[model samples]
Target: MKLKLAAAMLAASLPLASMAFAQGTAPADLAMIDACLKTAEKTGGFGGACVGLVADPCIKAAKGANDDVAKWKACAARELAIWTQKTSEALKKVQAGGFTDVIQAVNDSQKTFAASRDRFCAVFDKIEPGMYPGDASYCRLRETANHSLSLIKLGAAVNEH
Candidate 1:
């Protein structure tokens, strides 16, 4: 667990992946988003720079601005994996902080967030086009990422005690 947390914090400090505009070039990997997340945390905001970091560059790499739609879904999935793992690790960090009240509150909120995510993403499913699948995936990704940040912040609060 400590190793996972250490790796995550280390990854967050790494620089963002440089975007290449040429076709057939996606991010070499998803670690770039970690840098973006760290930036978001530093600035006390969540979605600004981190948003579209993956998909935009991916589309450009795929075939430029008019790239295939599949690129969007693929990029979303990849970034989602990264964010999901981060969120999970952050939650674990909080769980180990040893505040019973904080733990109980976090557990409660996590349960609520899970239900909320399902409904929120399902709403996107009702939209037209291939939006349902991709939209839902992005929704889950965004929700999970936000939840992860919130947990990290919560852990900080616990530390302050």
Candidate 2:
């Protein structure tokens, strides 16, 4: 009877563990990104500011004019995620405190981030031909949209508090 119960528990836990893995939240990665973004966003209105700052220097070091576009773009994508994540965190923090100043910052940054992502999407639409192309532009658009949603939710959460 005990063995049967143990087997049942193990079977149940296997599905639960798989569910967690499928979610891909990676709490440690999320927390680290959140912390970095928080500090970066506080210093600059958007975390992308850090990436933008580096982009120019990286471009100048390249031997060919068009040589670094891919590299720069890849960097931009990473920075965008970091900035968006930071903005999301800031939105939550502001909601926690009901700080009016942070609200404007969050809204403004969200717009900028969205615009950047939209520009990326435009590039994607120009080239790739597919119903759901697994492209960087698509990823950026989704990230920006998610960040915007997070801001809205954070505002509501703060208002409630």
Candidate 3:
């Protein structure tokens, strides 16, 4: 009877777990981003700012470029580089202390995240047709920044465990 109850409970929770995972960005993450933006606005520094904080200036620059494709591309490149470097460093930190399974999971998740980012950003191409590079770059920057932040937090959690 105990075993049956356990199995039933597990089955019931599966959908809830799936829903959380399917949402991609949880409410907590959105809250964090909002808090970070507020803090960044108040402080004008990256000290306690969230992952997107690093890309904030680049985004601003892109917007200020007045639709100049070259300028927008430049800002996008900078933002991408920042995201890539930070994510790589965080992943390495996690890998250094994680077990084999943990390391493998992190590796697999990063790849999956990258693929998802690309596909998600591709939608922006159609949103503003003919703005190919700029629109796509903006989407990539936002996605990469958010992913980098999540990876950093994940690394901290892994280290804690």
Candidate 4:
């Protein structure tokens, strides 16, 4: 529960994405996802240039600090907010594609993914006391980003046909 408590405290104290930007920690703008997606659309994938566009810089900035793990988690949480937003937009696009069954399945899958992530992170906190919050936040960020990308790809492919 330490990770949960830490995350909650951090969330309450920080408006994550904005804090990351105001601190000059995350070089990429929060709106930069749009450009990444546009590049993905042309390149058929989010290449290295776009991958971790926000997180990489944020994490790098936090490196070597005494509370590096905590800083990394905070950085991940910041980018996670943007990815969460991107997930919503991508979900909407996929839903608008008019594949009722596919949409329903994706909805169910998303719910399950959230539940699973919460459960896994909670247990992970107990198992790895030293790495609780940072690891948890990184897990969340990775999953959210992957789900967002998946939905975007699905939307494009579905609409193509």
Q: Which pairs clash in model 4?
A: none
Alpha-carbon local distance difference test for all models: 0.58, 0.45, 0.54, 0.62
Clash count, one per candidate: 1, 0, 0, 0
Scored against the true structure, residue 82 in model 3 reaches a CA lDDT of 50
Q: How close is every model to the real structure, measured as TM-score? A: 0.65, 0.35, 0.57, 0.71
lDDT leader = 4
Q: lDDT per residue, candidate 4, 21-134, as tens digits? A: 345433355558668778778877753355466766777777653547767777677777776656666676777788888877876676466656656655554555344445
In model 1, which regions exceed 4 Å deviation?
1-30, 41-48, 59-69, 129-133
Candidate 1 accuracy as lDDT = 0.58
Better candidate by lDDT, 2 or 4:
4
Which residue segments of model 2 deviate by more than 4 Å? 1-51, 63-66, 99-161
* TM-score of decoy 2: 0.35
Residue pairs clashing, model 2 = none
Task: Show model 3 residue runs off by greater than 4 Å.
Answer: 1-66, 129-133
List the pairs of residues colliding in candidate 3: none
Descending-lDDT candidate ranking:
4, 1, 3, 2
How would you encode candidate 2's per-residue C-alpha lDDT over 76-147 as one tens digit per residue?
A: 343344334444444556545556676556545544554465556666546543332324433552454355
Quick one: ranking by TM-score, best first?
Answer: 4, 1, 3, 2
Query: Distance (Å) between predicted and true CA of 29, model 3?
Result: 24
